[model samples]
Target: MDSLTADDFFALDLPRHAQLIDGTLIVPEPQGNFHSVSPYVLAQGLRRTAPGRLRVRRQMCVVIGARDVPEPDLVVVNASADGGPCLMSYAARDVLLAVEVVSPDSEERAQDTKPRKYAAAGIRHYWLVTMDENNRPAVHTYELDPHTGSYAPTGIHHDRLKLAVPFTIDIDLTEIDRL
Candidate 1:
């Protein structure tokens, strides 16, 4: 069989949550309730606070390479990349930030694989959300280090997340409990 390509990945009738990574199709297990709801909550917070020049979306994939298209929990892109209703994904250059809400099942990909790919794609920012000891949201932010083409830790937030880059973003992590 031929290896899956990004063009083929989009053309197939696959599950909504499926992803194409390194020419392989990966269908992750159904997420836990908290895992399932994290993106919605985070996206809601971002949408409400993001500058008009940016747009927030949930379960959107960024086309990083010919064989790499990983769908992140949430993606923030420039308003021009919104592409209206027909567009299914955004080009990597258009993505401003790629966010992954880490679940037990997805930790490896979220923490390692996806970040590497996003950084290589020149994405400006990446956010990884995980649960803290109290089972509340903790966001780890990273910015691309242009010299190395890798992400560097910017901050780790528990009670609240405040960032000036990618436009001002302030979120109360406890909001995850509402789910």
Candidate 2:
């Protein structure tokens, strides 16, 4: 078996869905319909409420380091002074909020894998949206406590939440569940 270090993984330019953690390659499962819809609804809601102040993107790759680039489901970036997408590679500092909508098959991916990685990457805000068996969604927001290297709950919105940046808008969880 071949042992791949983070450096080696970073050097490969293959264009498939993959992430490097420590020194291992993680192949992400394909996102399904529900997974796609949640981000869409959230992004649209955010954009409508906070136009020009926040940039919301779906599945945008955030380059935390040469060996660590994870495509978060929804990333809310600070409004660029130039009023355009911050085309430069995204870092922990640029991210105002990161969101992951859990797919039924990938609960662990959201609940565990991403939280740890985002914390390590120094992302200040993170959210994991989990869906019930019936596909009803529940949203959990985590704010990274830099000193502790852990995420602390700022709030849990079962129905709606007004995010911290880009704009102050309420997101309806029922609309997310319908998506």
Candidate 3:
């Protein structure tokens, strides 16, 4: 295995999805605009409604453990800790939620890679947003069951989804279609 750590991965200027798993570097394909925007909308919504309960960030590197650091599309962390640096370096317990906007070229990465990684890292909540051909967003929310190391589907939102913390708000899916 490669001797790369999360610190080593962070030091690089590479563009694709570069993560460190078990001290090995993994570079997945790059993301597209459609993949990027959906998460942006969600992040903005979280910031506006639940400023105290949730922290919305984009492309923030989270260190799930010593050997793994993956930068998710949007990370919903504890609101009190918003200005902190490198999420990947934080303990898995600090991550309140993790969201991934699916890239057309990296469907498998979203469907398989992220779920396994996040579940292993002990993230409590995870979301996967899929964009239709017209670029509309469909949201799937998962809550991790630590006992099984599996995520149970909590809800699916097509047009709008209700967010639970910081404040109550609805994220309109129609905006995703515009992206």
| Error of model 3, residue 28, in angstroms | 4.5
Q: lDDT tens digits, residues 1-179, model 1?
A: 57899999998999878999999998888888767767777888899899898999888888999999999999999998888988889999999999998887788999999999999999999999897898877889999999999999998998788888888877877887776
Candidate 2: the clashing residue pairs are none
Which window of 10 residues has the lowest lDDT sum in candidate 1? 33-42
How many residue pairs collide in each prediction?
0, 0, 5
Off by over 4 Å in 3: 83-90, 163-167
> On a 0 to 1 TM-score scale, where does candidate 1 land against the true structure?
0.96
Candidate achieving higher lDDT, 2 or 3? 3
Q: How many backbone clashes does candidate 3 have?
A: 5
Q: Candidate 3 lDDT, tens digit per residue, 37-99?
A: 777788777777755666677777778776778777888777666556733344466777888
What are the per-residue Cα lDDT tens digits for candidate 2 across 1-179? 25565456656774565765444566776777777677777787777876676677777666666556666788887666223464534666677778888775556767887788788877778888876555655678888887899899877676666765434778776785554
Candidate no. 2 TM-score: 0.77
Every candidate's CA RMSD:
1.1, 3.4, 2.8
Q: Which of the two, 1 or 3, has more lDDT?
A: 1
Ranking by lDDT: 1, 3, 2
